[model samples]
Target: MEFSHRDDHNNLSLTRFESMLKTNNVLFFDSNEFENIIQHYLENGKIALAKKAIKMGLQQHPSSTNLRLYKTEICILENDLEKAEEILDELYELEPSNEEIYIQKASILSKKDQHQQAINALMIALEFTEDQDDDADLFSLIGMEYLFLEKYADALSYFEKCLEIDMHDYSALYNIIFCFDYLNKNKEAINFLNNYLDENPYCEVAWHQLGLQFTSLKEWKKALAAFDFAIISDDTFVGAYLEKGKVLEKLKCYNEAIEFYEMTLTLDEPTSFALLRIGHCHEKMGNLDLAVDFYYKTVHEDPLLDKGWIAITKFYNRSKNYQKALYYINKAINIDCENVAYWKLYAVINHRLNFLEEAEVGYKKSLDYGNYELETWISRADILTNLGEYEASIINLMQAAEFYPENAEIEYRLAGLNFMVQQNEKGIFHLKNGVLINQEYQFIIKELFPSITELQAVKNIIAVTEKS
Candidate 1:
């Protein structure tokens, strides 16, 4: 049976149905009805209800273009591009001229892996004009879409087009600076910014860009002057104060940087990145205990920030507090176990704490997840050798040597392991190569080659290699 709901004033009986669903804990709308409900809910800014209704609709109309568009919107909101792209292909076919449909499709494409094609589509969309008047005007929209796709050169082209039409287009002007920064065209960016600032000296955004550009060029003193102008333009500009602190830090003005960061915290909730920077400055200034405290608070304030956790872990490791290092590294792993750096760090802390078995597992996990580091391989081999797994250690060391054959230290280490296992011929081969590569270690040659009583042969090999 098709359930038709209506109430007074010809309104769809949505309020009555929703009220009943809430009070009785009932699921009222099926796919078609739920989609209609979501369209009405979205118009009224009831986004959460709209989301729930769309989800319900998707269950029944999984392939419906209209329902799929709604579902795609939800996915975009949730930052799930994969699911959004799956739904978008069908949606685009149903509404080819729909600007929002094309824009959303391009966004999903950019997120999913075809950034260049997505940028081309957005630029093509600019050729077709629309009646809607928005701050992200058509050209500005195309420029931003290019920015999101990381086609900074194309983005600059579009933004410049917008500025040619309206020089006071602040959004396009701001985006132009961002594009310039990304392209490393700082000189042109500075010239454009200086002109903008001359016309509108109170533009905090332009001033901030100018300051950051100066900072990038390592003109710290000039960067400070620009940042000061930004703050003067708008005392409430949080980014100005934060950036000024970074410039001061670069100039080795730690106390001043701390004061600026502290001032930023007074304006708003302390940013975890800023807190970590402050902690680093304090650590550089020999206030280790205060640095630790700041780092701890940074992690507590924003547990999701990887840098905060990393800062705390490094602090503990530097202080030789093995337990704290283990604690922070484990916490980071719990949050993002798939990250190779986190797993590597976990392995290092485990190894430092003598958790040999766990460290080995962590190292293997790190390598499996694509962590390729010379140090990690060397350390893992050393651990395996210490655990009496000679074959595994030799295999790992050999693989490492393939990538870094010229590393004398690694060659020497592998030779020692081979000699320990009574592979005298192999040990002598690598040892001679190692000494040839780095004759500074010639003093240890006799001791390493005690079994090879024929020093004349070893000397002959070294002489031939050095001549070659």
Candidate 2:
């Protein structure tokens, strides 16, 4: 805030000073002075005051381009990009010769997700640039804009142009690598990176990128060596540990993967993905309790992590704890109710628990949402049978058999259930078909339908004995 005395020594008074202060309201300060005050407010972490000062400065000096620019920056900081664009539009028209205004407009457009329009504005900024010295910065910024748009070819061209203007620009070099990777030109990427490494061997990012490329090529040993070099360059590189763990997982070295994942977690905040992978490794090693523990930890940390819920539910089901299986399955469904797999798991656990009604509802929900698999139909049949709806169960089995004609297990289960409830003709037909499909039916044939042969062979003798 600036104050210039209003009058001569005889008239200088407290009342006059106060009146000047109230009317001027810091407006007497030049653009640079106001900007300094704004910057001081920002540096002191008084963001709202800084914004208010910027707005006051812009209102006081409506034609002051710098003041308007600062106000536009404040609008961007407050995430009111639409207002920023409106300011930029007026500024661009007033100062068409000022390339900075165009650049600011491009930035505001990019923030609003209008990337292509931002690029065109940047091109226009370049076309009317009276000063040649600022072209490199402008080109580099445009390259970044293209990169964000995923227009890799154009990004590469602009990045290369920036390097031609300033040969040692790090941003241009990094953008070149990114563009090559985006275009899947791995050979060129490797060449560029190798050259970069020759000049800068301690670059951890270069080593990590090389490791990723090796992993993509399935050269696991080389990938491991590259990641080791990366870790040596920067032991704190979390990405190196994570990528190494993933490569180990791909090589089927699950124990090594778990170790790497654990180390990565130590370097960064533990993620649900890492925890889930640890659970998977333990499950593969047959450490069921450890697997369940990790999965539970993951779910507790992030209830929206549907995979952890699925993993724990599968573990409980595998252990035949149908009640616990049902619990986690419902938790998963609650988190992602639209997912068919969660519903299927819920149905399966319910069926195992003999909660026939609940199981039927879950299976039907799954079928309605997703593809109807043979197992879903089979489970539907089993649930119906358990509910004493034998006819409905047989109907589902008949439909499932059409889809899985060679599934002798389906036929056997259907026949066994029919025989259990005294549906003799249907039981005989299915059992005979099951035997035709699998000749091993004789092993339990008599036990399954006890009266079929015994009653046929002894009915007359039993009748005579009863009469005598």
Candidate 3:
């Protein structure tokens, strides 16, 4: 707030400073006026101007503490840590009780990746801080230092101290909740938030955090109550409205979820999240036309939203509209080429439309992208067999067997494919393995490869297994 006693005085300092810079005039200013000019440059992010002001201000007033402090701050911002430290060491000799000196020392230590040492410097700063608000600020700095050390419990304690000084400090409140969440202490977090609400009942952020904690515990009804309280505290809170909608949806109150979701549209701008939720609610309620409409709107509002395209494709796919489903899925794939879910759905749609080659490519991509679902493995194996790639089918099933060794279905598939390729010994071995896993699935042998069932070894194995 330098030169802040009057608006015209503040304007006059900046104007005269800039005029002197352009004219190369050796103009004189008092130490306080130089500070006002330098502060204006610093606050506006005009670092070069601030530096020039510092040089001139120092030459004019050789012993100004504020001017020297500003120079040290510039050095810190520019990462000239050595020079910054030299200035600070000099300043410390002058004013040993200056908290800003210690704070800047903490900043320099932090930049050197010395988080524990930074915390130590901040603790010294705390000893010198006389103002209650400055103490809270220093506490936040120490809490951040603990966070950088991955010491969540220590960070939480300091942030809690910050809240004790100023109950309305939202940043401290958020940091405290983040620590609780990182420690996975949901129950403890709920108790803490409940205590906080007792003191500051209208804190919507606390209520919102309480709701999220209850949601994580799967206490859906309790989460709904918490979100309701958040809305009561701040009706315009978009996060509360969205979370309430989700909780209602989880409770299968689809229509009620839709009501709250629509309210969000009026309170905020059109969001793809709200539109997507409304589409899901419509789909759950069997309103197919309305469901598709909202899904389309979801994609239109946010073209990169893959879930919206997926919803549209799923809706059409369920209606046996293979072509429509494939069209929407293509859009999703174009946006995110490596998305496993998109490629998996693309394979399903293309297979339904009898595009076997492209369907096989899609399945291959889904597997390549880490979609290791058992169904994906079997589906790709089946597609390989259809394309007359029997050896590839065997290899696919063998890989799946590695992931799911005890599955009788994969064992049976391996048995049939091995026999189809005239690998008789492997076929008989897999047949016995499959029957031992589940004799009820011998139909896999009899139905898919009937000739294998007629073999003496196959019949004998099944007979012995059934008796056992």
> Best candidate per TM-score, number?
3
Stretch of 10 with least lDDT, candidate 1: 1-10
- Model 1 misses residue 109 by how many Å? 7.2
The window of 10 residues in a row where model 2 has the poorest summed lDDT is 9-18
Per-candidate local distance difference test = 0.77, 0.77, 0.91
Q: Sort the predicted structures by TM-score, highest score first.
A: 3, 1, 2
Runs of candidate 3 with Cα error greater than 4 angstroms are: 1-131, 145-150, 217-222, 398-402, 405-407, 418-463
* Of candidates 3 and 2, the better by TM-score: 3
Give the clash total for candidate 3. 0
Estimate, for each residue in 1-468, the C-alpha lDDT of model 3 and write its tens digit: 544546897788788888988896889899988888888877778899999999999999989888999988999999999999999999999999999999999999999999999999999998988899999999999999999999999999999999999999999999999999999999999999999999999899999999999999999989999999999999999999999999899989999999999999999999999999999999999999999999999999998888888899999999999888998999889988989889999999998888888998898999899988898888888888778798998999999988899799898889888988989899888987888788888787777667667777778888898789
Task: Estimate TM-scores for all models.
Answer: 0.69, 0.64, 0.78
Q: Arrange candidates, best lDDT first.
A: 3, 1, 2
Query: Model 1 Cα displacement at 199 (Å)?
Result: 2.8
What TM-score number comes out for model 3?
A: 0.78
Runs in model 1 deviating more than 4 A are 1-136, 144-151, 163-174, 321-370, 419-437, 441-468
